[model samples]
Target: MKKSRLILSLLLAFASTLASAQSENPPPVKEDFKPSVLNQPGKEYPQVNSQGYVRFRIEAPDAQKVHVSLGLGGRGGTALTKGADGIWEGTTEGPLDEGFHYYHLNVDGGTFNDPGTLNFYGSVRWESGIEIPAADQDIYALKDVPHGKVEQILFPSKSTQTSRRAFVYTPPGYGKDRSKKYPVLYLQHGWGEDETAWSNQGHANLIMDNLIAAGKTQPFLIVMTYGMTNEVKFGQLSSFDITPFQTVLLDELIPYVDANYLTQADPAHRAMAGLSMGGMETRTITLANPGVFSYVGLLSGGSISMEDLEKSPDFKKNVKLLFVSYGSRELDNPRRGPWGDPKENTAAVTAAGLKTHFYVSPNTAHEFQSWRRSLYVMAPMLFK
Candidate 1:
């Protein structure tokens, strides 16, 4: 009885100490977590806190391991801990970048999509996605003011031997005035993404609608198409040829768009812009066919130099606006172009009597947020 009493006293004292420690320092996680906005219709598993940390609850009862492919920096994603209830749950080590991010799940050495979230086309496949709400997300939000329609058209492409599909965004009042002709901006997505990226992921239509409704930009037609003409796989970009895509854009899509839509149909009223590898396409195509585009814009793409101008002498004379942009984070270890720093190249081009503009998005990397912000800034300066 004496031994029993002594053990009971020790147990009670240890419990009391643990209780005191927990009460004195609560868990660091905030309690105000909500389901991700990108979650599927009624499913709720992935949640985000005020600090942008993402919490994932996955159901894989028999799997030996489960991992989330989204984490801060180079942590190699989040590893979930299984509970007695057989649910795998974990939180990211740090907050993720704001905006839509494509991620996948690793289940027992195989890849799978999170059943709770919607899938988006990225990384050359349809992968699960989550959106960390941005402070400026209102810019792409659906507003009651006015809205544009994203029309899909199949244009004949003789070069590719198949009918190509493209989405065209006509401004709010586009159909109302049948006689009004608007300028056109041809937009391209990144390497892995296709034509739908601008519409689905980037919200190109909403960006243009908000800008037009707010009177910040002139209403125009925005066209988005697939940039990969040769089906080049990853790590094969060096062998990628731009001629096929260029032919489809200039010889096929542009003519089809002009004939089908109410466009100005002249080089002065046409602008071309792209992101990432799409930017490389913009640089190659724009320089190769200088007379075809009046306004050139590249987002996180390559830069133009004096040598390029010398190669295409008509570029300075015919081009109305030259816009270049990159996320500030991308310049951390600035990739030197053939000429020099991209910013310095823009400055040199500007000093040489050509209309040049450069913009760097703050606190973003080579993600869609940077490209979205680039379009926002370049829209107003086009066709001026």
Candidate 2:
């Protein structure tokens, strides 16, 4: 009886100590939420808390079912409960990854956008977008700096037989020196996104503006065009052909850009980069035309292999930089993509006497935030 009493006393003391520890390090309390920056003027329903939980409100009284298509789970997973006031509202079960996310409302079996937030083009259509403030958002934050102009140019593409549009970003001192020819980076958007993505979604212009002001990156020109990815559905990726878009970019767009803009007009100063499917396009086109681009970047897209270097000797010889980056969450996933291990592949490329860099974004997935961070890390290394 004495021994049993002693054991019971020890157990109770242990429980008390554990409770004290928990009280000292209590679980995070839900922070007060504010209207998301992406919300429409005076809209207060689509809000985000400091913990990254998204709260959505919809005034659909007659809707039988309503759900949000974003958050930890997939589409139609976040079921909104109808309140007594006839307003359908819900909060994400957990925190979302930092950056922008596109979501839509499914009400009464019909897909619709949340009227509270602004729309962004994704999945080949306009969907409501929200911004979850990031810890390291200062890198892309709008500052009092010399901003560059993102000019839209429509260049004729005879292969497609239409006037294809492209957005160009000329650095701050571009017009000041008429004779100065800036190096060009032919940047491409991911699948389902068009030319405006780099500007609107990724804030490529603002990124460059801040980088230039801080002297963190080289002032250069950036060109973004539609990668013709909308025609290819997600399941039918294998059926996508590169010949047409390659022809349009190489034969038409390059010539037009050189003729119109004060570009360096040499292979040593030109580069190509893309995100996701756009990265796949960059790899194909860069391999096919070795002399066109000296630097290459792939953001959440893919990586270059030893086999690739063996086949394209000229690219291996002349390429100035081969940069590959993916979000850390993607690398931690079970799906390591088609190239096997991107990190190991990049290490192999580095071992083969070529300048190579592999960057993994912290706490992000395959989103614009990853691509934006990739551009920031890779831009300073270009044309040097």
> lDDT score of model 1?
0.81
Alpha-carbon RMSD of each model: 14.5, 12.6
lDDT of 2 by residue, 1-384 (tens): 343233223322221210011112323539699999999999997999988878989999988999888756333346799999999988876777788777799988898999999888776778888888998788789888888899999999888778988999998878787798999999988766788888888989998999899998889999999887336664544456777788888999999999999899999999999987678779878977888999999887778889888888888888999999988877766667566688988899899988998999888777888888999899999999
Report clash pairs, candidate 1: none
Root-mean-square deviation of Cα positions for candidate 2 versus the true structure, in angstroms = 12.6
Each candidate's lDDT (Cα)?
Answer: 0.81, 0.81
Consecutive 10-residue window with the lowest summed lDDT within model 1: 14-23
